[model samples]
Target: MKISDIASISDAQKFILDLYPNDNRDFSYVFGYATRHLGYLCKSLCKNSPSVEEFIRSISWLLALANKLEVDVEVSLIKRHPDICPYCVVAPCKCRWTGKKPAIGIKAYKIPEELFYRAEQIKREKKADFQSHCERLAIIYPGNAYKWDAIGPWQLTSKMQEELAEVHEAATRYLSGRKSIDAVAEEFADLFAWLLSAWGLSFPEGNVDDSFIEYYLAGCPVCGNNENCECELFADLSTQLVDSDKIKELEKLFLALSSEVGFDGDEVSEVLQSLEAASKSQSEPVARAAVDQAKAKTEELEKLVERGAKNAKNATTIAQAIYKAIENFPFVG
Candidate 1:
């Protein structure tokens, strides 16, 4: 498959779902895995590791969350950033020159039939890399923060963690019957935006070490099938598998931390159950609820920055637990 066809947000989601056909993992697990890979990306950057595998993995999880939540990633992106900077309404982005805030609720100009086409147009028009795209997006949709200032990689990673926590909380609320899935989807979108920002920061030259499409072009990386994969050993056997005992230990640690932090365990498990159900059946209502829940969570987090910080820390712990559980399982397919 061509990169253009496979790399579109929709196609990527389908490809990932196909590789893990039996996946009934919850939204928390998905978000947790994504966050974990992002944390790895941050580690690689900090340690000056040349590998980009973690970046690709992180992006994959974000795309998977987008699929699970039924969010149109392409639409979300293009709407905020078209051919020109949505803020300055200029190709070269005159936001700094104009010293004015981005116009509110502006629509995208020249939306293409395919998201890939739009991406290419953006590349040509701006001569920008992945990181630049993120910067432009921050300018266009500053959210409620009022100002669009340059943030360093560390800050970007921190923001990414914050968004991840918001998504987690939204999922928890959805399980508790206090919110809808749409709210969850919205927070997932925010998390995705931050992941993209991290991606750009990690690879400023626009050179991704691995092509997501190419990696999966032949189907499941392990089973080598587009459907009905039957690989008993899903993990990349080449890497050391995380010990099952270690995972259990980490799980206990996570539970302890969650309790200490006053997280609702019942609600978290309920959200996970709902997410698993949604994934298995692809139920429209269930997926839609998750999206609305994501949106609600985002709004709620914005209002509770201090509490959000605590939640973010908890989320990191949860993600660490998840990584311990699956770090050995390879689905690079």
Candidate 2:
């Protein structure tokens, strides 16, 4: 399950379906996981590498939840956005800057005659990949990076949280028959824009498509499996269920990526060895220490990228995500 396999929204949805089939998971479960990763993503907003990795995870879970609900993400995006603001019906929306006083005689939610042709044209276009999807949002609402810079990452993350709440509100409305599913999809599309903005602001070095592919190259970051993760479902975090085989698989991935990041493969192997050994330890303190070591190592490697190490950006993104997953592992005291 490489990133290319899930480049477009439709592709990503299918990739998620392949990894975690709808029949095996319920909507609530999938939504819970999505929100859970979204929470982690928020925490990493100020950190570029970790945030990019978490963004990929968060979006993947969101796609999974959409699949469980039988939502057509690509179609929803097209209908709600249409290469322009759904409300403003114009590219590079001026609603905020213009104080919502759009052109006269044009009511809210109505596409004007001048823009209708372009909107219809965009709808006929093929589904775009993650990078193009984010880029489209940038086009629709330009200057997001500048806005994000002015407000700071804290405010950026806060905006993301707000959008997620709107998604919840929209979903609730649909479930209660107060709104249509299309409305819910619109909110999700907004959330996706905010999320992509967060990623673009922090990590502007490469396209999100490449970053996502790098982190998810091995499929499930935890279990290292392509389809149907072998890791215990995160249904309960209090339980201790460390799988040594999965740990070894993660270690192998780290080793394979060491040279790509200009890091010593032996050092990378040693860090995971400690993590593997600690996962088997009876003392909670030992596992906690190993988690810290892995985190410190991840940070050090990221610093190497900061120091201009070749190709470290792609490799360290995966390293950050892997360590974050380890830190959040269901380690019991």
Candidate 3:
């Protein structure tokens, strides 16, 4: 935090090296992990910024944070930079820029959403060795956020709202007759992921890179890669997600963990935070409180919790998650 501390930081790797500077391997591992976390935090904060200038400032601070830690994020990118964003690229960039709007130079590099979804599924179902290879190279490059966790529903909400709602509609249709809560949930979450993108918040951790490459190149010069890159996004990502109320709700999640008997983990914390942030922007204080109550009851006996069960029914965040759970099996005491 101090200016001196800020200046002393080096490449993300070096800053990490300082943590355990003597133990070479451990130093590298911890630094990479820490930088990864920092990246996610930076990406998160960037969404809170209102203007592009402010966004740039947000990023600069992240770079400085990496510097104080001593990371050469630049060289790291040069060595391992991804040719194409493996997550949301419609066309593998030919690395050309004559201003804006790239004309798909090569058809081979392009993929439609249908095929893209199929490829994504195949990667998920990859053979052990193949999967390992992908995972192994994951943290080390142009960012593997897309490969497995590629299709972030919340992150890609806009594109999904534009395209995937049909899937959710179909799911809703299925639920009308069969009443499978889980099915409804799957579709809702899938559609939600895409819808949330319109808000700039994402379901999964949206990451940032602290590599020196960020300091110099900013993004992959070849492709439109930046902290704001849509490829890094889960959908046709926008950058305007913010809600003090949701943030307030997220703090309540710690209480959710303590209040709930058996459902708490960093994963749950992160998921709860994302869901709250991605909800429509309006401060419904009473509704918020009721939603928290439902979350607390979730692990207990919830019985046929239907629409308007209480003020909670109106809290979209709680209602969606709870209804999905209760749709088929409402927690009953």
Candidate 4:
């Protein structure tokens, strides 16, 4: 299914364009180097992380930055699904670690972090929420579905960090290796695209067009593949099993929730709270009310553009929403 590995995508292009970092391509390796450096940085930054909750929260903060950029990090795991490399289709993927073929399912290693592996571990138990068709992906590329556990804060080694720095420098040179001096910086930005992906961050958002997936998920960030900007995206995370009713409630206040892009990190902790509200308000009233609210919002947007309302175009849609609401209020001066 891996859409990214097979063909280019729209969202991916929008992502890369936004990440314009330099003028050249040779220096793009800095992104790859950042990948290796992250583990060490994460280890140090999360040293005081008490429980998995603390760890997930820290990671969510990182996720906030990712969401703003539209990186589609799920594609990162799919791109690196070791099944193709080791041809292993099972948990632990012993073939990757041991370089040996397995009999039935591939054997694997002991993942380090308790938090990151939470999803993967659940997957290992056949409990990951998935579709009947997704099971096919499991059959053909059957193994751990996600990369969270394999890449924990404490999972990387010291030698990896040293090598990452070297890779960063190499990528830098590649960006401007043959191009004009000004082009080097462009290359650096490209490489940074890879670095962010490796960090499980979304690829840059500006790349969202015909050429995005290709640029963001490019197989080789350094050598410059002949298949440049041709990566594919198999699934859309927005459509996946994250409990929509919950998301709708969040989506209802979505304007409000988007206090930060998608939703505020602070509000993420209140996800369960929102979910409970969703369950209680399953009647048509909540949904009908939401539809009415959304319609009102759309009409407001049209008014702003139509009238060229002062301080409107300069404001975000949500800001405009608030502004319009205030205007409609009948409070006494």
Please report the candidate that would top TM-score against the real structure: 2
Write down the worst ten-residue block by lDDT for model 3. Answer: 1-10
List, residue by residue over 28-145, the lDDT tens digit for candidate 2: 6777777777876776565433545667778888888777666777766666666777555667787886665654457655554545565467657754776776777778877676
RMSD of each: 17.7, 9.6, 21.6, 19.1
Per residue, candidate 3 scores C-alpha lDDT tens digits across 1-333 of 211232211233333233223322332343343334333333443343222232223334333333433334332222122222223332343223423233344343453443455445534554222112223233322222452255432333234433334433444465367545334434433332222222233222322222222332444222344332223212221122334444455445434432333345564555455445434443345335434544554433222233223333333344344545323211111
Candidate 4 structure lDDT: 0.34
What's the lDDT of the predicted structure labeled candidate 3?
0.34
Rank order (by TM-score, best first): 2, 1, 4, 3
**With candidate 4 superimposed using the best TM-score fit, by how many Å does residue 330's alpha carbon deviate from the native?**
48
Candidate 4 per-residue lDDT, tens place, 1-333, comes to: 122432222223323333322224222232432352355344533342222222222222222223333343333233233223223434444565545554344234432122235435433544211121123233333232243245433332233344345434543454447434223332322332223222232212222222323333443233433433332322112211233454354344434523323333443434434444534665444433433454444444445445654444433565455445333321201
Model 1 stretches astray by more than 4 angstroms: 1-4, 80-152, 207-210, 228-333
Best-fitting candidate, scored by lDDT: 2
TM-score, candidate number 3: 0.19
TM-scores of the models, in the order given: 0.50, 0.66, 0.19, 0.25
lDDT scores in order: 0.54, 0.69, 0.34, 0.34
Report how far residue 192 has shifted in candidate 1, in Å: 2.1
